[model samples]
Target: MVRSSAPLRRLGAELRRLREATGRTQADVGEAIGRSHTTLVNWERGKNKLSKSDLVCLLAELRVPADVRKGLELLRAEAGTGTSPWAVYGLPDWLRPLISFEEDATSVTTFQPVIIPGLLQTEDYARASHATAPQLAAPDNIERWVAARMRRQQRPRNDPHFRLHAVISEAALHLYVGGVAVMAEQLRQLVKATETDNITIRVLPSSRGDHAGVANNFTVLHFANPSADPPLGYFDGPLGGHMVSDAGDVAAMVTMFDDLRAAALAESESASLLAAILEEYQ
Candidate 1:
């Protein structure tokens, strides 16, 4: 019974407005609620859903009057019975959390060993790539999936706090799912995306032996919400996707990323490597 996030997002916005109206900083609000400033920040930014107790405390501390509190309580109760829109389309249940994370992430870093990360993929490239995916190949479902992926790209434009960094394997650039022309265009898009202030692209050359990400694709999502507990890790599998948020697991993934970064080419070198591959495709 995951609810549509609209209510939660609105709640966050209202909380922020209320705090501002009261001329209270996040720290001040946090102090009143006996939580850390970061946690309060996360709440106001809609990066994390509030627990029942946390919501009650927040409403009390914010001095939300009876009517507003009752309305919020109703929304919360309703949230428990509604399904996430994504579930209707056959996305794996576990992957649902990633949708919310993507919506609120301030920054995302991905290590893709096999394919172009989805957010940067062109529509034709995504369609062709999905055509071979047995589980996702149903024509109707594929269109929905492609639409979802394309929509993910809109985040950077819509969310001023959003930033992305990607490290891609050289093999991904050379694989011509939609032929040389499409691949070439995709590479050009990557180059263009790199020029953006909030995006960075790096290539892990095929010659770079024994990389840490040889095993899988993984992403770390960092929240801008000061109240966010911590960054989270996600990866895909036959069962869809899995999220790892336990402190130790998240730390290990972060450490792995750091090691992989060290093993891969520097940003400039990676860009040069990507350019060379694009030239070959041309």
Candidate 2:
């Protein structure tokens, strides 16, 4: 699928701000209008284009002020006028919005059922993870991808306001992506990430059996500016990935995050587990 055009993305961003102004969840507006939160999410993220009538109804439902609504109408006309540079970097079209969303997010809560989450991965671990994929065999391209992943990690670590709450499964820790040394380093990195005040790490033990996030990995991104953007939910699975901004969908994802966090080991205990596993590699 083609990545959403910049204009469409702008339209989405505007709609997001309006929704934030109203202080409503995508689910809340979706329910009132008998639409799914996914619809709202896509619309705001620019993945799903909004039509004239749909826009009319949505803006009305959101109680968008007349003057502001007029500006949005103009933005809608210019939707799909351009593209994102990430496409040139070999990133998939579908993955673009996720990267963009992360750029603007103030806080992120991620649940990973297997493997460490991307932002926390070391270069070797990332290479190994990608190298295992036969489809992405190009070494140069892999490096580009790895470099991009590393770039994504920078702001979250340096920015005092970027909060990351990552929940991993015990299975992920045991599964060696790179060799023993690489895995060891990755484990150490996971432990090191905890040192940041804004970063929180938890582990869901295999003994727990089943949990809310067992099906797939998902993330809920919270924007700092309520008037400019609202919370959105993103899912990564077999069919690329999906971004959901509906109040209902966002709420459901939030619930899932909470449940998974509850089932996961406490931060201190998770660190201990990492330390214990780190020893085996040593």
TM-score of 1: 0.70
Write the residue-wise lDDT of candidate 1 on 1-282 in tens digits: 665444565566677887788788999889988999988876775545677888899888888898988887776664454445565556545656688767657788889888899889999888888887767467777777777788778987566568888888888888888899888888888877776788777888788877778988999987765343367789996557877756678788888887777777887787777778788888
Error of 1 at 190 (Å): 0.7
TM-score result, candidate 2: 0.74
lDDT of 2 at 200: 94
- TM-score for each prediction? 0.70, 0.74
**TM-score winner:** 2
